[model samples]
Target: MFNLFKKKANEIACPMDGEVIAITEVNDPVFASKAMGDGFAVEPSNGKVFSPIVGKVTSVFPTKHAIGLLSDSGAEILVHIGINTVDLAGAGFDILVTEGDAVDLTTPLAVVDLEYLKEQEKPVTTMVIWTNSEGKEINVQLGKSNAQTVIGKLK
Candidate 1:
């Protein structure tokens, strides 16, 4: 029998093409400690960052180094591009979306200049974290990924 009150699960797509790794493996202590929340990281092969969930844009940092999304299933996701890249002050990032915009897996969140980050010696491990997940569970399938890859699910 189907349950009417059960909330449907939401799929999380890979935000970029790269090798997906455990969140604990991220170099940033804040992310590695899960002090922010749990999710995965990608050492990207290219510059494009896509949406990993279908939701409304909660916030896009002025530096264009991070974007926040509130999933339809009630999960808050923060897509932070590059470690310590924030200190660059948006020098090599291109913000493609704005707050309050509805975005799906195919939506381009931003474009990072990989070479610039490399020249600046910034770690280009992008993180997709759940900022506020107290009673929910997330299942992530880590490894190689592309923009449309189903990397995880929010339940």
Candidate 2:
């Protein structure tokens, strides 16, 4: 029982299976909150959002935009599917999963209308964040390829 907490085995995987387009380098709280500032964003050319780690769907925003996932390893990841997409106010977005659902690494959570998003000039920003940042260290592995490629890993 004690060994469970003693083990340092918390490994958070990439939320989406896609090549990384952006990563979080800025450490400012203000910048991180903005739509186009800090945090990692992935442009999934495939238009599908996957669970980065095995966790419960904690919260699905009322707008049907962003999703909050709590990994079994205790990592909370926020997956925001597109850039300026919140402006759409739930338009052009289709959510397949709901809150409290158990999800795997390959479960499809939502789909963004890329064609419609492009018409609106919204950039997709998919962020995998360590919601509890006080004493945690996050390592993200990235690959060089198109958005279709699996490029980022978190550990």
Candidate 3:
């Protein structure tokens, strides 16, 4: 019986490779409003949605619009791709992963259509919320200054 070669896992990766449009706060609005209109909106941007941490896909909403990830460290992160994307009913989107699946840093979970999202006047507010906020302190890592980074580490 030889069981001594397992590599210790590391923290998960950032989900999106774009600017940090928004982060989870205490007073976040229930719904995002359009910048120029009186309705909910979302802006389309092309990018691969990645897993912020190594965890299980707890729940993938029926609309394929949002995903819930439970990190190995017991931090629950909810990643909402776009505004009102649920209304699109899975249009202009491609989901590469599924629920209960273990994902790593480089795993491509989904492909987003940002152009279509912008034409619709939607607010592309990528939200990263810790459902269990009392357990861990989340700190976001910022890149140089131009690139938007949403990477968070447990401290």
Candidate 4:
């Protein structure tokens, strides 16, 4: 029998160096409750944020606190930086890409001032949520990871 209709899983790389944690474990209620879809979060060890998938930039929030992407395999992802960091009004974030920019796993998304975020008393737990994975399942490996690590897969 010729096998057909088998969908390959799309890999999601880690966007930064950190310990990856389950989406439920994140400190934010909206993301913790899966209200924004399923994904993972990272307690970053540094300040650089990279693209976690091969995608096109769908949105770059005005406050520079989050970025939206449409993956090549059709997963809609939202990468949100910190808890309430948006209130800073783009003070500690440097946007590296604009909307519509094509990006791969290695592409730098933004540069955050970790020290500034700390000084502002913000929780630097970056969340990566799959905003539109209605029927798809995402499985993430929770542990230490770097930008090149394939932390999750969408199937």
Candidate 5:
């Protein structure tokens, strides 16, 4: 008998609620061009971003503007809070997990002060990039997504 369809990978949940769009739609060239990796951008509806997979927090910038994670499945996800808000010098970003902390799909990595960023004229759109996504099957869905949404699978 033929075996039933099976899924061998875990889904990468949407790290935040937003309008999910391709990286090309991002205003930044590095992300928009997908030169780094194949991932997407989120025109964030809120400031809080959750862990997209179960993994160790590889790095949390001193500026607290971005978070890097490595999943058990070897997915490297970088969550950048805003566009050029790094100039805010971490003023509007609050990172919850530190380096080497184990996090799951629902774990909140950071909470941003969207209002503060707006006051400083910063774009609150975030990027979820798979740093090493080259040559892999890009399995993400583009559109509206949330923490509970299985946006894609990373390998």
Candidate 6:
């Protein structure tokens, strides 16, 4: 029964499949400067985006550029779809979840038209940030990432 009741991994999951780049490498100052929190950006290989954790969908930006999640432990993760794609006014994006929805790692958050974004001259660098990462433990791998990959554990 002990093994059955063992705690699940407390790690952040990849919201999309792509190359994971350090937040410091992101072009946006709000993200790169760790202003929002410590996380990474992904140069997405595809258009589909998934939820990074089992949490409550805190907010879905009206522009459809980002989704904010609040984990059970009160951690916040912001998954930004692109760099300044908000200018597109939700044209090239399709949000699959609504605010207050409980989502899991396998839940589809949104679908993006990467080609449209590319044609619009928008950089599809998705950034995932943990907003309150002041003095906590985070151990996420920075490299190639897949949907099921555990980016890192946070405490």
lDDT (0 to 1) per candidate: 0.89, 0.62, 0.57, 0.90, 0.83, 0.86
Rank list by lDDT:
4, 1, 6, 5, 2, 3
lDDT of 3 by residue, 11-92 (tens): 4345665444334221235633211111111122445677666677898877777778877777777777776667778765
Better structure of 1 and 2 per TM-score? 1
Give the CA lDDT, 0 to 100, for residue 35 in model 2. 38
Local accuracy of candidate 5 as per-residue lDDT tens digits, 1-75? 764532223578788888988888998887789887788888888888898777789999999999998878887
lDDT of 2 by residue, 45-115 (tens): 56677766667899888777788887777767777776556788888788989999987655778877778
Q: How many backbone clashes does candidate 2 have?
A: 3
Candidate 4, superposed: residue stretches over 4 Å from native: 1-9
Give the range where candidate 1 is weakest over 10 consecutive residues by summed lDDT: 2-11
Could you give me the TM-score of model 1 versus the true structure? Answer: 0.92
- Model 3 alpha-carbon drift over 4 Å, by segment: 1-12, 21-28, 31-45, 143-150
Measured with C-alpha atoms, the lDDT of residue 34 in candidate 1 is 88
Tens digits of per-residue lDDT for model 4, 1-155: 76463223387988989999999999889999999999999999999999888878999999999999998899999999999998999999999999999988778999999889999999999999999978889998999998757777888
Candidate 1 error regions (>4 Å): 1-9
User: Candidate 2: where are CA atoms >4 Å away?
Assistant: 1-9, 25-39, 144-155
Q: Estimate the overall C-alpha local distance difference test score of candidate 4.
A: 0.90
Separate clash counts for every candidate = 0, 3, 11, 0, 0, 1
Candidate 1 per-residue lDDT over residues 1-155, each given as its tens digit:
98553332398988999999999999989999989998989999999999899888999998889999999988999999999998999999999999999888778999999999999999999999998876777778889989867777887
Give the TM-score of each candidate. 0.92, 0.74, 0.71, 0.92, 0.90, 0.91
Give lDDT for model 2.
0.62
Model 6 Cα lDDT, one tens digit per residue, 50-119: 9877678999999999999987777888999999998999989999999999887778999999999999
When 4 and 5 are scored with lDDT, the better candidate is 4
Q: Which residue ranges in model 5 land beyond 4 Å of their true spot?
A: 1-9
- The reply for model 6, stretches above 4 Å from the true place, is 1-9
